[model samples]
Target: MEDFEQPVLSVRKINKQYGGGCASCRGPEARGLLKNYCPVCGTVYACRNISFEVYAGEILGVVGESGSGKSTMMECLYFDQEVSSGEAYIHSYKNGKANVFAESSQQKRYLRNHFLGKVYQNPLLSLKMNFSSIGNIAEKLIAAGNRNVKVMESRGKELLEHVNIPLYRMKEAPKNFSGGMQQRVQIAKALSNNPPLLLLDEVTTGLDLSVQASVLDLIKTIQRELKISMVIVSHDLGVIRMLADRTIVMLDGRIIEHGLTDQILEDPQHGYTQKLVQSLL
Candidate 1:
């Protein structure tokens, strides 16, 4: 399969379930009752049997309503949350390949340090409040083991320009910048190391239409110019249409539809997908 040609990232049969209440605290007769009261949402399965592949240079968009496990799945891919079962395979240009679930702690650390870049739904939270935009971008380089101050500064400026942030404002703190600019800075930070895969979690979610369009264009331009693959998670179909070659529509922790952007948009087969298309239209 084309998808098996050393995909940048692959998620296989992922089943993430939250644990239920403490049965140890309950009496023998009440043990059954404890099952109904999950300590975390009563032992719900946030994601079930989720499988997908993202090849290098492909932009795959995952769309769904709020509380549909979009963010949870992204978190898992980033290694921010441990998977309860199944696996995520990350193939790196330098590190060869490693299963996210099976890697030792040191191996996982190496993968995170060298290969992954993530942008969250809120740029403000992702960025450091104490650092300037340049500092923020430079920090990633430092974390990646680049120690030369001159090299870090040069790369930081190049990244800022690449993301369309002005050179003059590079010294300004992210908190002082507008929402759109802050998002651009976050993108710059994510691109600092030029990782093979980028996970964008609704980077344009709260922006105005005009700002949103600009951010989307920036992202598209960066993807092409950098030749990097991405997995964008959003609830907005319009956003997916603008950036994704392939779209995956998810609902209630399951993928309701997956296909070419036009196929999914113009001729949706599933009821949930149809509703999404209607909303977009």
Candidate 2:
């Protein structure tokens, strides 16, 4: 495991709420004798006091059930959603540092353009329907302001090959590829900008065991080769064990336990973590 004097990303006391009473304030129930049905308890809390750190070059896995806020917290950290409270800080080598919550629009744009990359579970959502794999990756690099189009093309080809997608397939739409291949294309797209921190949300979910293992191996190889920090959100303990240096187990939007992956897998301190491990066995 690697240690960092400063973490690449730090999240503290985050919170997110949705569908509050305001949205339902004027519903039919609020109009008459059924007023009690519009009780102000309509708000749903998606995240609360979530805190964690990702050290440079270390892979941190977050595991939890469906409604446990794993994806919400990841999205908040990545600035996909505005945090209701607390702070998310990203350490930047280029322009000092800035909190994801406190940064100005320009600063946030700088961070998104230069420092971060994300991979979603569905590759089709990430790709352009009208563009080929090479074109899609090249377009992102160009949009990020890389000057040389030929260099972008070359790099795109190299990345596709790096992810084990055939060079010939580079000209085909992502829809033409298998789920696993599409995922590989997504990985290539996320790496197109050479981001220092990568966030992966259920990257291997819904794939066969063999394909999942292969994708895991590819992710591990990329992490090792690039030495970039990674945060992976998944429910699969096997996937966490295969890729994570450390694991954090969450439930009901709170971290129940955290430690070295091997330690947690072998002897979990929290009942929830133990149950999860047992179910895997």
Candidate 3:
């Protein structure tokens, strides 16, 4: 195994709660001390002290059902949402010592453009539907400071090809494409800047089975070819089994079990994980 001591991405005690942390939520001396949920204040713990490490070239899977905070965690990492507390370190950022959570808006924008790529579950959230496929990919390259149209076009074509997009459809708008095709374009655009870390939030969620298979295969191929680190969030155990080397199981916003994907599937330790695995079987 590669040395994971210096992970490509390290997250510690990240907390995301949606509600004002009232004094009552903090201490019963004010109201009644609740551990994670605060009935008095209605404080919902989207992600509570979630911590993990994603090593270089490793695909770390987060498996959880809806409202389990898996998607919330991804949102926090991508900065689409804010974190209430905790730290996140990206190895390629400021020589690996800087905390991304503490970066200024300008610095965070730079990191989002050059260091991280995210494919949201909904293409509407990630893609410019009116723009042509090539345009979508070129937008990312442009944000990364590429001014040459020919260079951007060349890179876009190459990426589209890598994602198995038809070369003839390069100039077509993504809104006209099928769901799977749109996602393929999204992946191409996300990879246009060659980000070190890729965040995939249910990329294959609603696609047809065959389409999902192709997308998954393409993702696996790209990961192997580029050796990129990825954090994939899915409730599908089969998806986790196919892509993740290590997996974390979440229940009610907390990680209940984590280990190798096979180990977690075969011998789940937590009651929630056991039920999840059994449901899959």
Clashes of each: 2, 0, 0
Candidate 2 per-residue lDDT over residues 1-281, each given as its tens digit:
43477788888888776655455543423332121233455655567678888888999999999888899887777677888788877776433355678877676766766778888887765788668999888877876888897898899999999999999788998878878888898889889988889999999998888898899999999999999999999999989998999989988666889999999999999988989999999
Q: Report the candidate with higher TM-score, 1 versus 3.
A: 3
Prediction 2 TM-score vs. true: 0.88
lDDT of 3 by residue, 17-108 (tens): 88886766653232443545678878877887799999989999999888889999999899998799989999878878998989888888
The Cα local distance difference test for each model comes to 0.81, 0.82, 0.90
Top TM-score prediction, candidate number = 3
Which candidate, 1 or 3, would have the higher lDDT against the true structure? 3
Model 3: how far is 171 from its true place, Å? 0.4
RMSD of 1: 4.7
By summed lDDT, which 10 consecutive residues of candidate 2 come out lowest? 28-37
Estimate, for each residue in 1-281, the C-alpha lDDT of model 1 and write its tens digit: 12347788878877665674355323324334332234423555567678998887899999989867788888887777888778777776334455677777676666666778889988865799679999998888887888999999999999999888999989989888888999899888988887888899998888999999999999999888878899999998989998998988877666778889889999999998898889888
User: Which candidate comes out best when scored by lDDT?
Assistant: 3
RMSD of every candidate to native, in Å, equals 4.7, 5.5, 2.4
